[model samples]
Target: MNRRDELAANLADVRGRIDRACAAAGRDSAEVTLLAVTKTFPAADVALLADLGLTEFAENRDQEAGAKVAEFAALRPGAAVRWHMVGSLQRNKARSVVGWADQVDSVDSERLADALARASGEHPLDVLIQVSVDGDPKRGGHPLPDLPRLADHVARKGELVLRGVMTVAPLGMSPQQAFDALHGAVTRLRDDHPDANVISAGMSGDLEDAISCGSTCVRVGTALLGSRRLASP
Candidate 1:
């Protein structure tokens, strides 16, 4: 099979897994969004995936993501593709990114929240508070004690729609443990922010665990587009 065919097959496999996971969780696959993480991959691959009907994509870097967005927007006008900012967002570049991204998946602090708010005035912005599942202070997410305050702050922004929570499961720990902790956090978040029900906790490796723990979205990369090849502008 060609690369495109292989990609189709791989996407199908992940879809099947997602279906099984949703069934096991007493949920339906249709309710969740499968974000094909096309990070470090070329715009060509992204274009191909778009042709394959994957409307949502996640990217971790601004430089790469910005370039891809420009290229795709140029190629496909009014194409219904949603871009997600799923990495550490730098404060200085907040304005530009907020303009392009449909959702900021890593709004971990009140400062970034304020920045995004100011940048997105009058523009609808979906935000997910990123939680570091491992309690790794060096990492980018906020501490458990600080989520509600941050959520409330983001909610105040007319442009920022606090949709839910997103987290990276702790590395070197059991996947189930990590997803369970995220699930607990999500449950608490949903209590206060009823619309904040999205749990973006799974990835290519531990997607099943994430699903079992009721993850509403799972970010998958290599499993979808094979290995990525970075392209230059």
Candidate 2:
């Protein structure tokens, strides 16, 4: 099959898997929001998928994502997608992100949270604290040890709504380990912020484990888009 055809098949397969996973976990299919990680993928694929009834798209970079969002809004306004900023967001880029994205999945620090809050103003953007379930300092998320203080900071910010938490598994660590640590982190966050219950974990490969551990959302990419390519709109 050609690329578009392959993309359609991939989307179907991933959706089927998600449905089955939720069933196995004794959860409703709607409970897990599938965010197509369109990071390395280009705009045409995004347009195609959006036309195919997939309305949630995610990207890590500001430039590419901003371009794609603009393109989709102009060309495929009917899509009405919920864009997710799924990467490390710099403090300076907060305004741009808050302007376009419906939700940001990687608010890792109090400073970033404050910046997003200020930039959001009346917007009250939805945010998730990126916890380092991977235990990698080089990565963007806060360490699990610092979650409460950071969550407290997020709660105090009126412009940024603290909806939940997100995490990425370490490159070498097992998926179960990542899920366990992430779920534990969620429990910790809920101790004080009981409403902070969303766990943004899992991906194309480790989604089953993520759901088993109580993930409310799974960011799926290649399994839904074939491989990915980084290109401008």
Candidate 3:
């Protein structure tokens, strides 16, 4: 099958999975939003996906995503797409990230939140506090104890809008367990900030588990875009 045809088939299958997941969870399919992670993929592929009716896309690196955003705009002018930054973001890269990303799903530190707030200018940047479900030091998120403070910090910032919480289910642990912990955090966040209702906790592998635990958004890569390609030289 051609690449486009392959993507079409893959998208349909992923959609079916999401539908079934939502149905099994006794939730509406509209409760889950699919974010296609386009990191390492070229803008041409993104354009094709746009044509396939994907309005939301994500990237982990600012440098690559900035270029892709520009290229995508050039390729499909007036395309209404929402770009999400889903990778670890350094404080220094805040300006570059806020330039293109519609939402940032990995804000884990007070420093990063401050940086994003400062760089956001007149528009309030939508943000999700990355919560470390396993408390893994190597992971990119604030511990459960620190989440409240960080969420408050983001909510207090005029340039940053605290939208919700995000977490990656750790390896060697139950995905449901991790997501349930994340859901707990989301519950507390909503109690303080009712608008902070998003739960971005799923990926290509454990989306159903995430949805079962109240995930509002799933960041899917391989299931939609296939294997990762080496970066262009």
Candidate 4:
């Protein structure tokens, strides 16, 4: 089969998974947005995914994402894909990220929030607070206790909107346990900012568990795009 056919099959399977997961959780399937993580994949794949009806895509690194974003736009000028930053980001890259990303899903600190706000133009950049369910610094996320403060900062900060929370279930712990904690964090954040409702949890591996715990968005990469290509440009 051709690459496009393979991607179409993968997309359908992933959507089926989301539907079944949501049904089991007693939630509406429409509540979950399937965010295609196009990291390390070529812009051509992004264009194919876009043609296949994926409106949301995410990247882990700014350097790679920046070029792919430009290429994808050139390839499909009218495609309405929402690019998202889903990896640990440095403060210095904030300026460049705002140039491409529609939302940053890994804002973990007040300093990062400030950088993004200052770099963003007149329009407010939507953001999700990254929660460290396991308090692992290497992975980059704010501890549960810090969510409220960071949410407030992002909400009140210039040109930045606190959309919600995002997290990766730390290895060695059950994904369910990690998502349970994240659900609690999201609940508390919502109490303060009701509009902050986007819970970007889960990935290709454990999306079912995340959906059970209230993930409104799932970032699927390998399952959708197959294996990563060796080179990215």
lDDT for each candidate structure:
0.85, 0.86, 0.91, 0.92
lDDT by residue (115-166, candidate 4, tens digit) is 9999998989999989998887887799877788888888898699888999
Candidate 1 regions with alpha-carbon error over 4 angstroms: none
Measured by lDDT, the strongest candidate is 4
The TM-score of candidate 3 is: 0.98
The lDDT ranking, best first, is: 4, 3, 2, 1
Off by over 4 Å in 2: 2-4
- Score every model by TM-score: 0.95, 0.93, 0.98, 0.98
- For 157-180, candidate 2 gives per-residue lDDT tens digits of 888788899998888888889889
Model 3 RMSD in angstroms: 1.0
Residue 46 alpha-carbon offset, candidate 1, angstroms: 1.1
- Residue 88 deviation, candidate 2, in Å? 1.0
Candidate 1: tens digits of C-alpha lDDT, residues 122-186: 77789999987777888769876677888888888787899888888776789899889878877
Instruction: Estimate, for each residue in 1-233, the C-alpha lDDT of model 3 and write its tens digit.
Output: 99899999999999999999999999999989999999998898899899999999999999999988998999999999999999999999999999999999999999999999999999999999898888887976899778888888899999998989989998868999999888887787778899999899899999999999999999999999899995432
Alpha-carbon error at 196 in model 2, in Å? 2.0
Lowest-scoring 10 consecutive residues by lDDT in candidate 4? Answer: 224-233
